[model samples]
Target: MIRLDVSRIKNVPGETLRLDLNFPMDPVQSQHGQVSFNSPLRLTGFLTNEGGKLKLTGCLEGEARIACGRCLDLFDLPLKAEMDEVYCSECREGQGPGGEWVLFRGDVLDVTAEVAKAVLSALPMKLLCREDCRGLCQRCGTNLNREACRCSTDDVDPRMEVLRKLLKDGN
Candidate 1:
């Protein structure tokens, strides 16, 4: 619902503006998570007008719900993101370790896009429930933390069985 309006700076060369944004997380629109509100996404930065281009340099910070890697329990993930980008009428394509980054489109800069990019890039690949969670059992599919399983523990070593038998016969 927060739409950043930069129409005033359009086509103004060397114009600069500093802004702060606090966006509340709406779980209903979140990629994944229940309807729980999260900490506001704080964006503090400046945009520079460069005639036919715009440059944005800023840091974005916020908190969102994330599942624990081991336990699957939902928790809060702190996000701190820093971005430096240049927007132009002509798209600039560049590559990095992961892949290429596409610069934002022309004259009017969309602040919402800048914030979303920062947040998404900073998110973790995997979410864990807890650090010390006992995962589900492989044989019975029972959650090890909640219940115990009747799995076999009589593991035998094939190479040492002959020696074990010889020792029993005093050979």
Candidate 2:
């Protein structure tokens, strides 16, 4: 959990603060699979007191380990998420435009959720170990990247039998 002390600038409007924060990030479960962070997440930018709200704008950077979508191999992935989240002192916890506000009470702002959301959204939908990664064979389950598969490659779909028959008849 990462918390920021905003008491100094809470009541002072138009006050700006430069922030450089680094903290470890937990493993995130994504649609593709589990993504575990190998390095600490770094948020570097400024926080300005905007009258009644605290606006935080920063760039997040980290390294993570995830599986290759095509070959199912584990590899290191670099992460960089741009964030501009608002911390509202007057609004309720769950009220915002598409979860835009990070509700805070007293003089502290908990930015863990917003950071996690930014990292999650920054992850690519398709992860690949290499550009030309040949996926595993369906029948024999062979890693084509390492070695050649002995599975038969001439098996045609039954639905395409009519096209083959028509070509053969024409010949």
Candidate 3:
């Protein structure tokens, strides 16, 4: 967990704290797929004490192994995310248009949940091994990129048979 001690900068408005850290993360499993980080996530940025509130801005960089949505292959996915958050001394529950505002309960600001949230949000909705990934065949479950499937590709849907017949008859 990443914790920032805000005891000194609590009341200082213009005081800034610079940070550069590497944190190890556990494997995360979601409905989409499983993601595993082989190395520590590198974070670099600064935090400013804006009166009693804290403003944090940083960049997170890391690599994760994710399953491709189309091909179902495990491949390395590069992770890069920018974070800008506000920590108010008072309790605030909603996100702002620019960023998010969270409540800081005590002198310590634990950013573990924020980091995980950022990384998870940065993940792609559809993971592809390549831009032109051919993916698996629907009929035979063949890897189309590596080899050709013998299944007929020209078969039309039964629902469109009436239209097909009309077109064939030039009607």
Count clashes in each candidate, considering only residues at least 3 apart in sequence or on different chains: 9, 0, 0
Residue-by-residue lDDT tens digits, candidate 1, 1-171: 445556666568878878697877444323444423367778788877776466778888877676554545567778888987666545446543233343555344555655665666776665545545665554566666677766523364766656654653441
Which runs of model 2 end up more than 4 angstroms from their true locations? 93-99, 152-171
lDDT of each: 0.62, 0.82, 0.80
Among these predictions, the greatest lDDT belongs to 2
- Cα RMSD for predicted model 3: 6.4
Write one digit per residue (lDDT tens) for candidate 3, span 29-145.
766678888889888998898766799899988998888787788888899989888898874577454446787787889888788777888898778888777777666888877
In candidate 1 the C-alpha lDDT for residue 115 amounts to: 62
Q: What's model 3's lDDT at 117?
A: 75
TM-score of 2: 0.81
Model 2, range 1-171, lDDT digits (tens) per residue? 877888888888999878899998888878878988877889999889998789999998988789988779888888998999888888886788886677789988888888888888888877888777776765588887897777634676766666755653443
Worst 10 residues of 2 by lDDT: 162-171
Better of 1 and 3 by TM-score: 3
List the lowest-lDDT window of 10 residues for candidate 1: 28-37
